[model samples]
Target: MKKRKTLLLPLARQFTVILILFTLCTVCITIYSTFGYSRLQTSFLNNSLESYSAQLAKSTREAYESYENICYSIAYSQVVQNYLMSENRGKSYENYRQLENQLSNTALLNPYIIDIAVYGQDSTFASLCGSASNYEEFSRSLSDSRFPYRSAGVATVNRTLCHVLAMPIYSLGTGESRYLGILFLAIDVNNLLGNSLKSDENDYDPRILFTDASGQLIYGEPQLYDALCREEDRSDVFQIQETSDNPVTYAVTGYSIPGIEHTLYVLIDKSQITRQVARISGRQLLVMCAITFLALLFLFLLYRPLIRSLKQLTDFMNTISSGDRRAMKEGAVIHQGLIGSKEISEISTAFNDMLIETEKLNHTIFDTYTRMYELENNNRKTEIAFLRSQINPHFLYNTLTMICGLAAEGMDDKIISVTGALSRIFRYSIKGSDMVTLEEEMSIVRSYLMIQKERFEDRFTVRYEFSEDSHDCLIPKMVIQPLVENAIVHGLEKSLEPGELLIGAGRNPEHGYLAIWIFDTGVGMPESRLTELRESIHRSVYNKTGDASADLEDLNSQNHESIGILNVNSRMVLYYGTDYTLLIDSEEGVGTNIQIRVPYRLKSDTNARAAQNTNSKGENHVPGNCD
Candidate 1:
């Protein structure tokens, strides 16, 4: 009694929920089971219906075989095959009549047979249904006389469907003896197929129909054809469907006869069979409901603890959904990691880490964006100053030409050589354009040495070593001129004894750039002055001025006409960036080596034509002056 009381306490708590669920389940099961059972029963009845129809078709096929046999027997008869092989034609009527009588008797045994006919080769004589007749009636309808037999559907004397089966009778004799006649048989079409329906004893409703290759009706009543036609969803076979009318469930089956071109269909209605099964299903559902109610009560009692745990997890998830992260942190301690157990401790730890990491990443992204904005402003100002310093090649060319002419007419080999060097230098300047060919820039430097050689005469000597491959490469016009100027004005120009200048141009494939170095065996600056020049060239060109800070009031103010080493340095850095630049290699008294590394193809050479037009705006070229 104590055990029974404990079970009853749980049953009472789940009574309402289980009752509602049990009622809904019972109704659904009744509906589903009844539908499934009805379908199964209807399928069985359709199989039976198809079986009966197949048996009828087999019987009809046998009847057709019997009719064909009679025709074959006549075709191979000794007298008929002999007459057909001879030239007598129908002159031997008495013998032909005997064969006809035997064939007529054979056909009479076939219930579906309606008539028979025989025709001579010339179509002069014939017999039909045991009566003498002329061939005039079917002469036009006959096709070939050489083959054994042929058949066709035609109207009978009684106005009904019939198939005419005919065979060519050949004479049995020597070659080309004679020509005989043909034997024909008529079979009623409907009666031949209707034999299958007579064997079924069930109350199943059925419809019979015939159609051509296309799904158009050929025979049967109009209403019956339409009813069966609606269910013919496929061309290869038939379909079954539920209906509200008599014979509630219906299915259709179709087959094409082997020798015949027409298709036959048999539609059966088996609703009464499905209805009986539905009644049985309703009783089975009642028994299942009684057993299910007791099992559900026991399961509900056993799952009480699990249900409470699920409610606690659901409440924590709801707190997270409401944007209460603080509450979620506190709840994790109370719940002790998923249902007060060890199952989800890892998931709880991972989720908390993801939230905190996302917040930290957002702060880092904001700080980086602020830094980029400040850097961009400084870069824009420097870019403007670099672009302003690009010089005009044509103006430089005109000025050098004037200087060359003034020094040309003297006999002093010194003066003449200097003037010739001046001429070559001006010519080389024009060749520079925006992208002086490497060959042309080198020629200009050689001319510069020639002029210096005449001025210093035996005091200094210049030599060049350049790779053969560097001739066609394009670099900025006047790119090497600035470095050479620095070496002459600051290094070799101060030397007391004979000084040496060496220019080297070659490719450093390892660095992917062409390096041109100007080395002078002259006074070299200290490391401190070198550092100062390097820093000045690297500073943002935007704030640079033409005045040196030592000679001006405002050292930081921007300036025009400041075409120093810094100007060339800023332009090079702007276009090629940090990749290509000038490197100063020097030691006190030994020499100053200025190495300029540049890309094989400079950006200025690519825009040479445009750069020439822009830089030549303020100057015009004049013709040569003769004195």
Candidate 2:
């Protein structure tokens, strides 16, 4: 029974989570864009205010320069100078009637000028006292003051703010270099600044303030005097800042009027920039919202089919888990709507094909197992039949020939022993099993060697070296006897001198194998001959195209190498696998040594590879006979 999952969520709820995540991403992007735009707009407005302040300052400077030029005109005039140094020095400037009339006409021509006054510098009775305004206050104000040339700034006149331009008077003609008296001109703010600054569109004109080099106030709106004075700084340049208690932002900048000793400060409002930001922000919000809505709609359309296909696949997989073959085929039609997408279609097709293949493979697997059993049985029958064919008449014929030759020589004892060893060898080879204990195979090898020693008593010496631990090891039958036989027939039989033959059986410490060696101190072959013999053994072992079938002809080959060493090598390979090799090492005129290695498994251990050397890898090898 399957346990119900407690944490499982429906597909719609899962999609709802996706929708929420998408909305969060949209909100984050919107907030980031809005923040960046606000910063850019603020920076632009700050820069625009600086430019507007500079332009206003320039206009204010031009307005104030006109007053300075008027002051210079009177100071350098020849008519004004002669009148100041009148022959009638005893009289006041009123006695010079033409000078008074000239001053009054100058003031009338320029409506901006509030008053034009000239005061005498003489230590004696003062000369050339005149006022353009025809006001007694101008005379009284002028009489008390003494100023240097080019002194220009803003001042209060008749309880009204005014721009004042002043300059020193020089003597006429030859006395032009000499200073005589000071000339003064005061211009009304409304008349002088209105044309350039005041707009009919709005009352919000940028106020221009004037101050002399000494930092004294010259001219500005009287109402703004206190506020501006409070915010006054030592530096000539201005900055935009919010007022201490006001919501509005204001900017100020100062410019020095050329050729005049005055600084003009232009103050502008900052609300003009704020209005633009509000308008831009409104438009941006509308555009972003519309895009976000469209994006959400697109996401819904995109993921809707995917979610439905996945839901169908999930249900189909659940039914598949219950071993329903119908669900696999049914899945194709269920998610058919998603087939337009290549990846989804491939996934669906693969899922169905895999399930179908798995079902067909179920029956094919049993057939394969049955075939494997039949093949193993055939291999066993083939190996036994090969051994029966090789060992029966041919081996008996060799023994009978040896016995008949011995009988002709009248050696009855030799024939009896040889016949006994030959009979034991034939019986062991014909046994239907391919496994034998190291002790049992060594007994057979000794019996066989005993017969050879009798036949060649004076030709060679035979020695045995067997380790006690390896005596009971299970290995392939007749694996070592052939190597000893080869040493006797090929090595000692051909040599003129008596040879030494050694047979050794021991545990190979480096590998899990029983090492059996046969060494002969006879005339050995060269390195080239040894390599040739090694290749011959390899060909016989791997005789078949594949090791799937047993090659019976490999055991029955009558070639000298194929008869003894090759047969031994091929049989050991077929039984103990290729890791077991019949290694032959020889040197010219020194000796020849042959080593046969087989897996060392104990006879008493039922789980280990026993006589047949069969293991879990399905390796079942037969007992092989050698010359």
Best by TM-score: 2
lDDT against the true structure, each candidate: 0.60, 0.68
lDDT of 1 at 443: 75
Q: Report, for all candidates in order, the number of backbone clashes.
A: 15, 4
After superposing candidate 2 on the true structure, give the runs of residues whose Cα lies further than 4 Å from its correct spot. 1-224, 227-250, 254-265, 269-342, 358-377, 384-389, 392-395, 401-419, 526-528, 546-558, 587-591, 606-627
**Each prediction's TM-score versus the true structure:** 0.34, 0.56
Worst 10 residues of 1 by lDDT: 549-558
lDDT, candidate 2, equals 0.68
Candidate 1 local distance difference test against the native:
0.60
Give the CA lDDT, 0 to 100, for residue 361 in model 2: 88
lDDT of 1 by residue, 135-176 (tens): 235445554556545454344534555656666666655667
- Which candidate has the top score in lDDT? 2
Please give the TM-score that candidate 2 achieves against the real structure. 0.56
lDDT of 2 at 531: 84
lDDT of 2 by residue, 533-625 (tens): 887777766666443333555444435543677767766766767788789999878889999887778878844534335553345334472
